[model samples]
Target: MDPTDAFFTQTVVGAPFTVLLGRRRQPGGSQAEGLHINLATGESRLSQLWQEWALLSHATPPGTARTRPGRVRRLMERHALWVAVLGLLSLTGSAVSWGLLLWK
Candidate 1:
């Protein structure tokens, strides 16, 4: 299998499990153990485990499948284009500031 494909699968499936399980173990052990366990389980099983855990953790009452985003998220979603424009403008401003600083 392609290295990229393997990495992407690991990122999507194994990473979350590693993160979740990592919190429970001693700090040094967590990182090593998480990777070892996740890799040993392989992608499919890790994906299933992640999905099951996600569903359990994020469980909402039945029939409430679609919930509205929070205020900040909704604002961002609705004004994504504007946000991008503002971000670009801020970046330009910072670059100009840096140029002026270096020129001095």
Candidate 2:
């Protein structure tokens, strides 16, 4: 959802942390609180959400989302492969060293 669409620059009243609230019309023709996005307290989580939102919303003329993914996304996607490669390399190196020692 667009941040501006769901929320305005105004903050909610009497919140422990900075929160932006959006109002929606109820069936009774009264305004009701619709969204409550806790901005300051959940900054780290929201930062990722915002970055992902930017990657999705910002578009080139050709209509591609983005050339590069966010840091959190990149690490999450590659963490397993990198760890597996390191483990395999260490195991092979240890085997090779053991072979040489056994030969001597």
Candidate 3:
């Protein structure tokens, strides 16, 4: 599916039962779990996600000014992995540097 295209499904299922104290087996015989899926998407993705979400009063117009991501967010989005392996390696190196100073 394209990033712009969206598909939604909502399922409703429930089994109503009551429990009593000192119950070895279930009081009732059995209950069937009935579920159904329905699409909640409207005419367009913008209507369902953006407009209903109140992100904007209306659909985004052409050339709407959007705030640029900060330096840290940009770094995480580009070339870098989300896990931040470099951060862990740096922490290890810093610990070793501290150990060397103490060893002197």
Q: Point out where model 3 deviates above 4 Å.
A: 1-72
Regions of model 2 farther than 4 Å from truth: 1-78
Best by TM-score: 1
lDDT per model vs. reference? 0.66, 0.58, 0.54
What lDDT tens digits, residue by residue, belong to model 2 across residues 1-104?
A: 47663454334433233222212324564432333466877533344434554576544644456579899888867897887898999999999999999999
Candidate 2 structure lDDT: 0.58
Ranking by TM-score: 1, 3, 2
Q: List RMSD in Å for every model shown.
A: 17.9, 14.2, 20.6
Candidate 1 residue-wise lDDT, 1-104, digit = tens: 79998899888877433245223433565322212244665653334445565667656755777777799998999999999999999999999999999999
In Å, residue 37's CA in model 2 sits off its true spot by 55
lDDT of 3 by residue, 1-104 (tens): 45233222112323434532212236663542222234674332332332343554465564888778899888778957645788888999999999999999
What's the CA error at residue 90 for candidate 3, in Å? Answer: 0.9
At residue 40, what lDDT does model 2 achieve?
75
